[model samples]
Target: MKVALFGLGYVGCVSAGCFARAGHDVYGVDVNPVKVEILRSGKSPIVEKDVGELIAAAVEAGRLHATTSASEAVHATQVSLICVGTPSHPNGSLDLRYIYRVAEEIGAALRHRDAYHVVVIRSTVMPGTAAEVARILETQTGRKQGEGFGVVVNPEFLREGSAVSDFVEPPFTLLGGEHERALDVVAQLYADVDAPIVRAETRVAEMVKYANNVYHAAKITFANEVGNVCKALGIDSHKVMEIFCMDEKLNVSAAYLKPGFAFGGSCLPKDLRALTFRAKDLDIPVPMLESLIASNALQIRRVVDQLLRWKARKLGFLGLSFKGGTDDLRESPIVEVVETMIGKGYDVRIYDANVSLARLFGANKEYIEKEIPHIERLMCKTMDEVLEHADVIVIGNRSSEFAAALGRLRPEQRALDLVRLLDEPPESERYEGICW
Candidate 1:
């Protein structure tokens, strides 16, 4: 496959070299003549580890070319990758003039030829950016998008020093687009790569890079903040973090990573508050650490606000504890929601089998006896009781029974799911996920 790249910067130089090394004919386009001449002369325009050798070898093998003309590059290649820079403005918005210009150039190049071309947005961009590029293409070429050209947001995950290795062995290959034929063609180009091919909608693909980068930044800041505190307390933060990262079940793995309701439990909320309290007493500032409580409270407020708009007096709760199958109501988020609902004059009925059983002699009994004695009035005998008397059903946990109860809601009744009850949304029209 002949591939054309729109920028001869870091990404374009690395992409052209790697793709050509993988047996694809590559052409790089740039507005700057110096970068174009450097690549054309079989020398890399940018300095990076192992990239120059790959570019040199590909150029010597007659598989790589560079030009200053987008038309020249697009005419000789089957697919065009937008590798241009999206710089930040003073106000922090993306300056996407380069992206729009490259799209227009590709669109104009496609005007003369009737063959369908694939435009890949390999640059990091915001959601709906690919659609804007598609619109620009359609307006410029005077041909509908999906008819003459297809837009795919194929974001790259390469780092600065290890770009070659990252491109050769990415975590996974994401191919997000709407057109089937174009997606297949792009997938075939990566046939020799050893990575799982994840197909998603264009917006999701565009948002993945941002999510990953922000998470990475947060991780680094968290580690540094912990290290600072450890240094102040004469403890080895490295050893602490090394052991912390070894907990693959929860700490370093995919536990608590999904978008859902506010986190509240006996351990998390209590431990977080304790840590922040100690940090503040030590005269140390941990804004990120301190923000957890405020953020959690805000999430609870958001849930209350969503429920307030429902205009239903009778509210049913599937689970009341912080987690499913637990009778410990200590710091449970659903318990807060229920208390708030009761304060707002909504008739609350809760059915948690574990909590009901625990009321006999466990934490539930103690919590009801001391914390909120009124909760005893809200408790119901069975799930059927709540199902029988409520206008809106709220699923607060992932209890196995809650998934099937979604199928039993009446036509006028609705469900608000905090934890995703199923892998996919239920087939009911009245169901709403807090965050999908």
Candidate 2:
């Protein structure tokens, strides 16, 4: 395959070299004569890991060539990948002038060609960018899309320092295209890649790069905040987080990563408050850590608001403890929800198979007594008792016993799942998820 890689910058340089090395004749195009001259001399313009050597090898084998003319590059190649930069303006929005220019150039070059062409947007842009590029092509070429050419969004996930290795072995290949033929052409280009290729909607594919970058930024900020808090306490934050990351089941895993209700338990809320308080006493500011508690409190209030909107007076809780398989009630979030519902003059019944007055002892016992003093009145002997008495059933945890009672729920008796118990949403209209 003959490929024309526009913009001989970081992405374009690496992409052209890698593609050429993969047995494709690559024509590198750039507006800057210096960049073109450097690549034409069998050397990479950018100093990336292993890119210079790869370019030298590709050029030596006559598989890679550099050009200053888009018309020549486009006419010689079947596919053109736009790797131009999308810099930011003063207001922080994308400056797509360069990308638009490339689109016009490609569209102009397509006029001289008779074969169907595949144009891929490998640059990072917001949603609807693919459509905008398509409009530019149709306007320039005097030919309808899918008939003369097709556009696709194939986002690259390469880091700068390790770009060559990252390109050779990517996390995954994501292609977003409206035309089946175009998608197939892009997929076949990466047939040698070892990672999985995901075909998604054009908008979804375009937004994925932004999501990845933001999440990476958030992770760094979170780690730095934790380190600042730990420094004030004379504690080793690295060791603490290292241990914290070891528990893949809960922390640093997909266990609680989903969007759901507020988290409450004996440990999370209590330890977080204690840590933030310690940081406060030390006169160290950790706004991110401080905001966690406020955010959690808001989620609890949101649940109360949702319940009130439903107009359900009698509420039945499937689990009283913070989570399933636990009798501990210290700082449990649902306990706070129940207390709020009771204050609002709503009838509430709690049933936790693990939690019983006889089993409660120490701080756990005292905590429950202070929160819900008339605990004996609210406690139900069996799950059957709670299900029969309430108009709305709130699933507070992922308990196995809750699965058995799902089929027995009546249409009038609404079920609100605080935790996403089912992998997919249940097919019942009466069921609702706190957050989907």
Number of the top-ranking candidate, with TM-score as the measure = 1
Each candidate's number of clashing pairs is 0, 0
Locate the minimum summed-lDDT window of 10 residues in model 2: 357-366
What TM-score would you give candidate 1 relative to the actual structure?
A: 0.97
| Regions more than 4 Å wrong, model 1 | 427-429
RMSD of each: 1.3, 4.2
How does each model score on lDDT?
0.90, 0.88
User: Which residue pairs in model 1 clash with each other?
Assistant: none
For candidate 1, give the lDDT of residue 112: 89
Supply candidate 2's per-residue lDDT for 248: 88
lDDT of 2 by residue, 1-436 (tens): 8889989999999999999888999999999999999998999899988999999999999999999999999999889999999999999999999889999999999987889999999999899999999999999998888988999999888999999889989989999988999999989899888999999989989988898888888788889988987887788999989998899887776776687888887678888988888888888888888888999999998888889999989999988788888877777788889889988899999888777643454346665666567554698978999999889999988788887667689769988888878887687878889876
State every prediction's TM-score relative to the real structure. Answer: 0.97, 0.78
Which portions of model 2 show Cα errors greater than 4 Å? 30-34, 66-75, 89-117, 127-152, 176-182, 198-208, 229-255, 308-316, 346-351, 356-369, 374-393, 403-415, 426-432
